[model samples]
Target chain A: MEMIERYIYAVTQKLPQSQREDIGIELRGLIEDMIEERVGDGEVKKKDVEEVLIELGSPREMAIKYRGTKRYLIGPELYDSFLIVLKIVLISMFAGLGIVFVIQIIIDPVEILDHFVGLIVTLVTAIPQVVGWVTLVFALVDYYGGVQTKDLGLDKTWHPSMLSAIPDPRRRIKRSEPIVGIIFYVIVMVFFAFSSNFFGVYVFNDGGFREVVPFLNEAAFSQYMPLVLLLLAIFIVKECLKLISGKWTMKLVGYTVIINLLGMMVVSFLITGDAFWNPEFMSDLVKSGIVTEGSEGYQIGETIWKNSTRIIVILLLVGLVWDTIEGFIKARKK
Target chain B: MNEQEHIDKLMLELRRGTITIGVLSQLSVPQYGYSLVTLLNEKGVQVEPGTLYPLLRRLEKQGLLESLWDTNEARPRKYYKLSKMGNEVYEQLCKEWEGMVASLDHLIHTRKDEEDGND
Candidate 1:
């Protein structure tokens, strides 16, 4: 009887609140019936009850059968989508990290091994972190019985005519590419805005390698910081839009061309103003024996220093023209 | 893998689908979980008490079976019988089952004939 009570308790404990009492009473009656059938006119014994309970099987297993199907952290319905999202995130993480590792190696060729080792460590840690977070988000969505792919607005309004929305393979942008671009752009923007000294030439001086003499005049660059920030914001927005659409269209191309032209104009304005370069960088070059003061090398260096703004402006215009042409070409591609 | 295990697996699958019909057939009379199990086993349809009790509750919940608790004896017992809906459903299911068995029997015989001809 005690064993029966324990078994009933175990089974009922797993059941929903409203069904517990009814199920407990019903289970007890069934157990008593089985014991009565086994003992006949004899007094009911613990051993007889135990045997009946054993035949009934584990209380947890019985509870689960009553509960219909098993619960899952991520169920079958959302499993395909979960796997898709996980694959995209993991692959993007690896690719983005790989690109950064390559760029870091290029920037400091001496530390190539160190960068490679760091990349491996980052990938090892980041893969599981990304996978775990994605699983957790999917689990929460599943638990809440949130809307599925079939319930999407696109599914409701879907039509044969909308097949055009399926991007052409030739022109289609892989989503990870835009995401990686955005990440790279953000990193470059941050480095330039906060650590402008990193842009200059490194030289061994005094006892060890001294900080690079900054190429851009910090005070002068600070004045145009708002424009620089706006340009960065525009690039970020464009990349985000590209990621969302997963393909190029006329509108996106137009947007890219307009932003690039505006950026080129801003660069031209900064260059022509003659306040962009650090006046001190020329002296630092002479002191470092990079160029002899008043020598033929100094004359060439001076000429370069005076005409650098015009050279940069020409380069900016060329880049803008190339970008505009490339944009139209991509937009026109099948 | 072996012949006996293969047969057992096939039988398990066949029994899973037919157990509901077997239970419904015997529940025209009010029977408790253990009694229903005994009756089914006696009729050569073996059902575990674990499977039978939960199934009875599920059928009742689905409005196919109605239950009553009788405390007349020293111990109380919940007896289940088919509801009006249950009876109609059971009859329809029985007809469907008979049709399925007949069609399957004909298909099997036709296949057997082909195999015999080939041999």
Candidate 2:
């Protein structure tokens, strides 16, 4: 039993504290009742009790039973949506932690943590705008499709029946995987075609960025075009492939593209004849009247972040978009 | 044509007749697809959800079963129960089943000696 207590505690932690003790009491009582039924009156053996609990499976599963309606697997949400969200959350979390490990190794651990704190500040600062835009798009699409909020499964406390007037197609689309793949391949090609020479339309010649935004010079404004186009391409490819295959090939492609960009950055660093951070390079530039007294390392670091972050976010967002498209396809199937 | 004979052949009769009756009887209390499976399981009578769900739909279309959603849950579960005509039919079936078993057993035993002589 001490093990059972720990198991129960582990599950109960997921519940609200006010209800935790009550739920724990009920669960314990239920377990006792189950045990009694299994190994009856005279005297209950400790080993028998453990065996019974073990047979009942994990604390997570039991907690799910008590906490939820019997909608396992996909639950109440769109099955694909839940899957996509789960994939994105797990992948992003792991990747973020991995990147942090690399950062910690290169810099003082404390400095790395400070950098993390700064990154969080950047994201938290952008959340409202991002969330608002996403919600707007979702709402617009919903209303456009005559999706009654009343019909939405989200409103119900438990999973609701999805009633649609449209008759379900008996036969689903059946095309060869490679043929569908060829179409996707074409879509990606088209995407690259659109984005390729478009960013080069005006090389570093946009002075529209007002001065208020911290890095809002003409050069930054010009950089935005290529970054935004690349982001768009990622999003589009992800969306298209999601429609084609239930998989997120965009991330696979995005990883390759990001690595390519990183390679280019590395090449550019070589061409610039410096690591961009080597002390000798900074000092040489400083002596050449290229650097001023106020040229702190932080600005250079920020510039690198500003440039590389767009690529990382774009790649990851490609994953998210692909997942989103898959969700749509799955939802459409349902 | 009596209770004793009917009791003796009850198993054979139930194997064919009791199944339909049992299925029809449960519908009196509104049950959704999976709940019906649980109910049967708990009662030591196992029915596959695959079979039960489709059967419920067919029975509903045949006018023996009526189904509607219970919207109180997050997922709307479809509930099914017997119609009034279904209840009447079920009661009539139960009586017919009891009478048939009595006759069947009496017929089989009475004709046994005649069959043996022919053999």
Candidate 3:
């Protein structure tokens, strides 16, 4: 009897919560029936229970049979999308790091070896982290989403009306668009987040070694780092929505408009801040002997430096408006 | 793989679908898990209780079978019977099975006739 109880416990323990009680009861009755039939009016013995359980097979095997399908961390349904996301992330990471490496080499050629080493180190460290985070997110989605592949077609509950209409070929999004958008946005994010110093003037020293004078004030830049990263994250999310939908819809357009406007507002605020530019950038260029003070080159450089933030703000606003209009056009295409 | 192993593998595949029909055929009359196993085996359809129990649950989940606990019995046994939907599905399944068997029988006999004529 104890053996029977233990066997029932073993099988039912692996099943879903709602099934546990009913299956446990059903298994107990079935085992008792098997035992009774095997004994045939003889004294109930432990050997009879052992034989019944042995015939039923191992507990894990029984549980699997009940489950019907093998469980996965990221099941077959999401596995394709997971692979696509991983590829895009890896390619983007490599491309971003590559661009930073080139810029560093150009800015300070003497430190090219150091820049190459830095790129390798970043790649080695970041690849695993990216893969881990992506895998964890996909696994979480698979677990909580409760999406079954059978629900799409195999199940009798699925109906013809549930099927989506054939999408217009002209309206269908090219996979490359979102792929490129993701790669581009990620590169931009990484540039601002980690390689902002690379965007500046390079000068030759007396020893013929190149040196850089970055334009953004490091102290002020650090303050806006969190918001910059958030906007970039939102941009990546917008691209992901496009990738998932594979075509522009009203929902996608709404999301795009909202995200672009939000980004525009944040960019405008960051650009208008006086601390966003390095105050000594112009002075540093002249002191480095690259340009003479009061010369035409100096005057031009100063004017561009002063209006740089305003120009950036205008460009960003224009980009945001264009994106919103494009989204509306694509989504409303007949 | 050896011929015997290959044949056994193919046999398992062949029996998989037919097992559902076998189980459903006997479930028109309410039967507990062990009773269905015994009845199927007696009628020359070998089924393990372990296989039958899970399959019964799945069928019930699919709305093909209705189950109730018969507590009036000496021991409380979960009895399963065909639902209204189950009956219609089972009948359709039977007709399909007959059609398949008839075509297969014709194919086998025709091949044998040609072989005999050659011999």
Candidate 4:
């Protein structure tokens, strides 16, 4: 009886949550029937139970047979797109890293060997992080059904008439667009989350490359980290919508506009505020000799630095407008 | 790889479809999983309990069968019967199966005659 109970547990544990209880009950009854058939009026021995279980085959195989189909963390529906997005993101990471490496080597040729080693180390470390994050996002998107599952409420009964018309091929948003958007969002999110401390001014000296002036005030940046992460998450969700829809819709356009508006507000609040910027940035710039003191170049640089918040905000607005326009244009297509 | 193994593989494939029909045929009248297994085996269908249980569940999920737990029995037994839709489907499937059998029988008999002529 104990062995039978263990065997039932083994099979039912592998099954989905909803089916487990019913299946467990059915299995228990079935096994008991088989045991009775074998033993008749005699004692139900452990050997009879063992024989029955052995005939039923391994628990893993039984579970799989019951499942009817193989389960995936990122299921077959999203698997192809996941692979494509993964390849693109990894290649982009390599390219981005390579470009940065080249620029660094150019600045100070003496540290070429050290910089090459550093680049390799960075690539090695970053590859896992990138793969992990992409997989996590894709797995979550797969589990949650990407975009359409958001409004899948039990209150509304489905109708055949509610089925969307076949989209025009030309009107279909290319999958690469959303994939690239997701990749970009992931990269930005990763950079902000894990590597924000590297956002600093570096200068080479006798001590090798040193961060002479950190651009972000660590205390304040950490405080705003959650908000920054939230903004990126919303952006990723919007991109997920684009991925799932694979075509322009009014709903998607509206979502994109609202998300962009929300993002603009949050981002403006984050960057334009004193909490985000290093107060000593201008002084640090002068001290580092990247910007000179009391010269024509210095005067222009100073003026630009003084109104940098406005410039940054304007740039964000321009980007927001362009993105909104693009969404509307795509949605308007036949 | 070898003739026996090859034949066995083909034979398994052959039995797979027939097993579903066999199970559905007995299921016009409600029967519990173990009883259905026993009935099928007694008639020489030879389905594994492991295979039949899952197949029964799968058919139920497809709405070709409906199940109810009869707790009145000493041990609670889940009884399954052909649904209204299942009955219609089974009838249509039986027709198709008969057509296939007739066609195959003709083909096999003709092939045997050709082989005899060749000999």
Candidate 1 local lDDT, A227-272, one digit each (tens): 8867765665566556544677887788788888788888778877
State the lDDT of candidate 3 residue by residue for A1-334, as single tens digits: 7888788789888888898889898888888899889988899988888998999999998999888975678887778877898899888988888888877776778888888898888888989987886787678767765365535646877678877666676667888988898888778876886756766776777766466778888788888988998898778767766776778789889989899989988987887787887878999889888888999999998898878856777877998899888878877876
In order of appearance, the predictions have TM-scores of 0.59, 0.28, 0.80, 0.77
Each prediction's whole-model lDDT (CA): 0.77, 0.51, 0.85, 0.82
Candidate 3: which pairs clash?
Answer: none
Off by over 4 Å in 4: A13-22, A39-43, A64-70, A94-129, A144-219, A233-246, A290-292, B1-14, B58-74, B83-85, B105-119
Q: Arrange candidates by DockQ, descending.
A: 3, 4, 1, 2
lDDT of 3 at A222: 89
Docking class of 4: medium
DockQ of 3: 0.80
- Per-residue CA lDDT of model 4 for A1-334, tens digit only, reads 7898899999999999999999999889888889889999899888899999999999998999999873578866677767776786687677667656665665567889998998888888989987887788888877766435434433278777877777877668888788788777666665665445556667666766544466677778887888888888788778776776788888889989999999889877887677676777778878877778888877886687668746777888889879888888878877
- For model 3, the superposed segments whose C-alpha errors exceed 4 Å read A1-14, A32-61, A64-82, A99-121, A133-170, A206-209, A265-269, A272-274, B1-9, B72-75
- Give stretches of model 1 more than 4 Å off: A41-47, A94-128, A143-334, B117-119
Show pairs that collide, candidate 2: A157-B74, A158-B74, A158-B75, A159-B74, A159-B75, A159-B76, A160-B74, A160-B75, A160-B76, A161-B76
Model 4 residue B91 lDDT score: 94
Encode model 2's per-residue lDDT on A37-116: one tens digit a residue.
66777688888778766865677765554454333322232334333433332343334444444433343444766766
Q: CAPRI band of model 1?
A: medium
Q: For residues B1-72, could you state the per-residue lDDT of candidate 1 as single tens digits?
A: 999999999999999889999999998999988788989999999899888888888899999999999889
Task: Single out the weakest 10-residue window by summed lDDT for candidate 2 chain A.
Answer: A208-217
Highest lDDT against the true fold, candidate: 3
Q: How does the DockQ of candidate 1 come out?
A: 0.60
Docking class of 2: incorrect
Chain A only: TM-score per candidate: 0.50, 0.30, 0.74, 0.72
